[model samples]
Target: MKWLWMTGLVCALFASVQAQPQPLPAEVQKRIDAIFDGVVDRWIVQMDRWWHDGQHEHLINMTYFAIMLDPHNISLYENAGWLLWSSDRDDEAVALYQRGLRNNPDVYDMYYELGQYYYIRKRDYAKAREYLEQAIKFPCEWFVWNTLGHVYARLGEREKAVETWQELLRRFPMMPVDQMEAVRKNIRDTMTRDTTPTAGENTQQ
Candidate 1:
């Protein structure tokens, strides 16, 4: 992902090198290479700041320009979508994520990040659960499992949520005691709840 811009530049150069019957003149190719290198250098500087500071707007703009330079770069779409989503531009972000999926269906991070957006930002529990499930098929992260359990709990799938949390604790026994206790408490609470009380009612109890 860090080399996304360079990947774009390299692919362009490779395609230029593979050109059919005739290649570009040496001087013309040299000038094009220099121009591309300059653009990539600028992008690298901008992306460095983006990584350190959360300049989502600048990152998104750079990604758009990079995509225009190399449409085949899948990572550009992923990062751009992430930036847009982080900036609260949900519709455009979703469209970009879908576009990235269309281009490379195996990009599981897109699913994971999209699931996070739905879960944490949109509060769309069903969609979050679906995408997180898809993401787990590729790679299972601890936080994903944790969030998946929360999603199940929110959906009133008490047993499933309990099982999910139990599985996590079993798999990662060294997890902090307080965290494990919290999971256990959630399970116990869910098991004991006979009525679907309102938040205020639960709080008052």
Candidate 2:
């Protein structure tokens, strides 16, 4: 069944490539896109089944195929890398992330994922900080800021960590009250532990 599906995908992709020299009619293009989307959706379903059944190798193969079909799908890269990491294919996961960064140079999430891999898996604080810092240069999620702060703290840069958390609060003012308070508590705790500088003290200088 898997071989049949892969054969169909290969044939479809080959046909599409052969037809690429000529401009496809709008209606024909729409139908082609619909068919392609259907194939991808079915593949996703199969991948999910494989994942649940502990068929890690099969899932990883399908993930690689999915990336080949749609390299721009950021979620695919993230999920595939995570799967590899969880399966103890750590080198493959890092390589997959590097490939993702190559395909998506400007995406913040790729950097964030790499940062997380370094921080959590390798305990490489400097590398984590490097990637997390790059992640913040673009529009990113709240956790990026939070994790970067943690990285700074691990690196013994308590002041920078507090500032990072403070900046997170400033940027996401409408966040949930509990989350907001948690961040404030982190700031307070860090301040109490280290009296070197306040959150914005160094920035003022």
Candidate 3:
């Protein structure tokens, strides 16, 4: 993911260079250098530092400033929202992801990440299912389906969970056999657990 940010910076550098006039005005060049050095590089460093030290506040602020500098770079929005999430500012994180989606509706990762917050932390299975459904409509990884199945299970929708994992196998035929085996085991376990009588029912019988 950091590589995505680096690639964005490289593209920006190239675009700035190519857009320069033949004369390459001194002020324009200086501004470009300043943007790369002060904003882009600094943001990259802040993100790396956050990963190393768990410094979410500084990372979130720096990522926000980076977004201001390059609103078109979708990765900046993702990183900023993720920073807020890592800080446990979940509502703010969701809002930031929603804002990014408003600007770039095609970025499906926004939905996936937002859904992850609800599913993993808040236990808001409805919201998780909502956003994960949106995410699967577009191009995303297999894990989205896996998580959606978990959300379904959490809501006691075991049938839906089994179907969802089957769908994952259908959608990604090349997925590793071990992962598929895990899903199959999960489905079997859920079904068996459901059919098993409770201790109270056993006593009554």
72-149 per-residue lDDT for model 1 (tens digits): 566677677766877788899998777666655564666777777787678787998998788767656566666777
Clashes of 3: 0
- Per-model TM-score, in order, reads 0.64, 0.84, 0.69
The clash count of every prediction, one per candidate, is 0, 0, 0
The residue-by-residue lDDT of candidate 3 on 65-92, one tens digit each, is 5665565567777777767777788788
**Top candidate by TM-score:** 2
Instruction: Give the range where candidate 3 is weakest over 10 consecutive residues by summed lDDT.
Output: 196-205
Model 3 CA lDDT for position 103: 67
Deviating ranges (above 4 Å) for candidate 3: 1-42, 72-75, 195-205
- Over 1-205, each residue of candidate 2 has an lDDT whose tens digit, in order, gives 8656674666577566656988788998787778667777777888888879988787777777777666787877888899899879999999999999998989798999999999888878899999999999999878789888877877779999999999999999987788788788878877787543333332210
Candidate 1 off by > 4 Å: 1-45, 50-55, 65-79, 102-104, 176-178, 194-205
Per-candidate RMSD vs. true structure? Answer: 6.9, 5.6, 8.6
Candidate 2's C-alpha runs over 4 A off are 11-19, 194-205
Ranking by TM-score: 2, 3, 1
Alpha-carbon lDDT, every model: 0.70, 0.81, 0.73
